[model samples]
Target chain A: MKVVCIGAGNVATHLSQALYKAGFVITQIVSRTEENAKALALSVDADWTTNPDNIEDADIYIYSVSDSALGEMIHRNPRKNGLHVHTAGSMSLSLFEGYKERGGVLYPLQTFSKGKAVNFKDIPLFIEASNADDLNVLRELASGISNKVYEASSAQRQQLHLAAVFACNFTNHLFAIAESILHEADIPFEVLRPLIQETIDKTATLSPREGQTGPAVRKDFNVMNKHLDKLTDHPEWQEIYRLLSQDIINNHRG
Target chain B: MKVVCIGAGNVATHLSQALYKAGFVITQIVSRTEENAKALALSVDADWTTNPDNIEDADIYIYSVSDSALGEMIHRNPRKNGLHVHTAGSMSLSLFEGYKERGGVLYPLQTFSKGKAVNFKDIPLFIEASNADDLNVLRELASGISNKVYEASSAQRQQLHLAAVFACNFTNHLFAIAESILHEADIPFEVLRPLIQETIDKTATLSPREGQTGPAVRKDFNVMNKHLDKLTDHPEWQEIYRLLSQDIINNHRG
Candidate 1:
């Protein structure tokens, strides 16, 4: 299989490497910047081009650009032959509306950062296409790198993206908030490392509901009230505590 | 050093077993119920007793009881000489006020669950004491179990605990929300396992501010508004999404 990765960011960087490692020929690498495109292309032994016109026709075109810029990318590329796929969670695969019939989603369900090594085998791939043949092709492509792949629809992927906000993005925000609090108190955040790892590890064996602990789950009004009182000055933290505690209470009740 | 562990709950169970494994002589395991005491005592090859009076004087008396019942525990087990400590984050070492000479905090900064094998060496221990000598003794005891020991004050520990509620407890709630949303969509939550792991793995390499990726962080108001609109009925999820996005935005602005 041949692929033309249409961005030089984290997702593109990692996915291109994984595909290339899996023996898929990356025919070309395109990015807004010549340096980034050249760097990744050199690494993967593919042709590098900053101009969209230089993008070659291939079996697959992965538009792994920023979500906001995806529509603009589609407009610029204007490819009508091969399959055009976007590696975005929230963006609809239909973004490539005027393109070829092979347009679909090749979304790798993991948070990727530039230069960080990602084990594609452990990451899940959500594959969706317009037809059965395209779907099977995408599935084969996804299955080459990952053990877990699902034929999720655009609506389902959108809902999954909304949940991803809560699961991955928002959860990290919570960690940042906690880090900020500890920073202000002149406390090292390292003390909470074990607790964080254990909390994540518990989900491996038991459901988060069953493993839930703390004042909210225990319904210790005294501790809850104490924590609320402390967060009075920080309304954001207070709002978070209230909303999450209410969720915990509602979860337990149900 | 000789140690007497009070309460046979998760912390007590794991702590006693670890101490025994580390070649420390655990003289006794005390609990409100004989069965609970015996269960942990047998693991450590120590004697068990339900009565507080049966707690023989050791080099250290570690109370691993729930926060609410701490005061009564201290009152019941009056120690004349050895360093007495409690493993609670919010609670102060002053809870052992009557025994001013040898009172401290030996907080194992981790969430412990019964039936889970916890490697004590990996868990950080936050220690605090009323006096210098007692601090050293408590520090020594802590060092035996974990290389990561910090002499944190009562105020520092309280802040750390509050931070933990956001980092660990509330983060788990986010996972619960994700699980619920996936369940509603008839999508297997296991598909998100890799993404979840990557979310955590990203933190190890970069500051969460540096690692932040999503529609919210990018201020892609279109996707954000779409998600909010989708979550109109699920007010709880909407509130979380709003609050966390705002926090992320505020943090990233610098």
Candidate 2:
């Protein structure tokens, strides 16, 4: 199948490469920036275009652009006889209102980073389509690149996105907060890595609620107060500590 | 060296087993409850004692009891010639008051769950002592069990404990929240495993601040508002979402 990737960012780069490796022909790489477009195009052995009007006609047009740019790109690109899909968790299939028959979603539920090599086969892909045929196409395309694929409605995908914010985005912020705290204490962040790894590893065998530990869960007010006192200089961090601790306590309460 | 293990909880069980495997003689297992002490003692091939006074004489006394129990155990147990130490993160070396020459700490910086096997060599061991002699004993003991061992002051260790609360405890709580959100949507939490793993793997190369992503970092008010609206039934979660998102936005703002 021939595919045209509609962005040169991390998601686009990773997904396009995966698709190309899975025997799909990436005909073109289109982006607002010539440099990124050219770079990705060269990597995928595809032609590069800076203008959406120059997008090649292909069997599949994957829009991997940022949420803000998705609408504009959708409007600017010429409608072709192909499947139009987005990789965004938060966006709906209705974004392709005019091209209803071809509109679909092939959202990959994983974070992408530049220079990081991810095995697409291990990543879960969530797909949605307006019709059975388009759904089947998306399913086959997704299955070719990933072993884990599921059909989800737009509302379910939105909820998945929000849960991801808590699981991935917010969790990373907590790690950042830990790093800063260690920084102030002249301790290296490396010391906490094993603990962090063990914490994540426990999730495989136990539910997060059952795996919970530390002062808040134990209701050790003395240690909690001491920690609160230590964070006096950073009131924002103190608020976060207070709020998260209270929530844990509330959730665990009989 | 001969050792008496005071406590039979997760920390005590793991630490005692490690010590036994490392060729240290665990002379006795002491706890307020006979069943727990006997269970741990049976595993390590040591005698068990419910009475603090019955704690056998040894070259080292490893107190792995809870914070509330530590003080009473210290007061009741006869101060032997052995070096005394604790495995608690929030506790201070000064907890061995009046037994000045023997006071020390050997804190393993990792979360311990019952029945889960952990490699002690990978877990960071943080040690502290009131004097040079005790410090050497702790350094030797810690280095014997762990490749990653460091000398940390009481104040620094306290900060490390607090940082861990954010990194491990609070992070796990976020995972629990995500699981609940997915549960509401009839989606399995397994779908998020890859995203969560990637979020952590990124930390090895990038600072958490540099690795931050999602609507919060993007300042995408539209997606953030939609997420908040989806969380209307959960007022506490809404508060957490708002506070954490605001913090991420504030931190990323130039």
TM-score of chain A of each: 0.94, 0.97
Candidate lDDT scores, in order, read: 0.84, 0.91
DockQ of each: 0.67, 0.84
Two-chain DockQ for model 1:
0.67
Assign candidate 1 its CAPRI class. medium
Q: What is the lDDT of residue B18 in candidate 1?
A: 81
Best by lDDT: 2
Q: Which whole-number lDDT from 0 to 100 does residue B209 have in model 2?
A: 89
Ten-residue segment with the worst summed lDDT in candidate 1 chain B? Answer: B93-102
Residue pairs with colliding backbones in model 1 are none
Model 1 off-target regions past 4 Å? B53-55
lDDT per residue, candidate 1, B1-254, as tens digits? 78899989887888888888889999999999888988888889888889887679888888888888878888888566788888887888778776535789977777766676777898888889977888888777778888888888988888888888998889888988888888878996677777777877777877666778887788888889989998888988888888888878877884
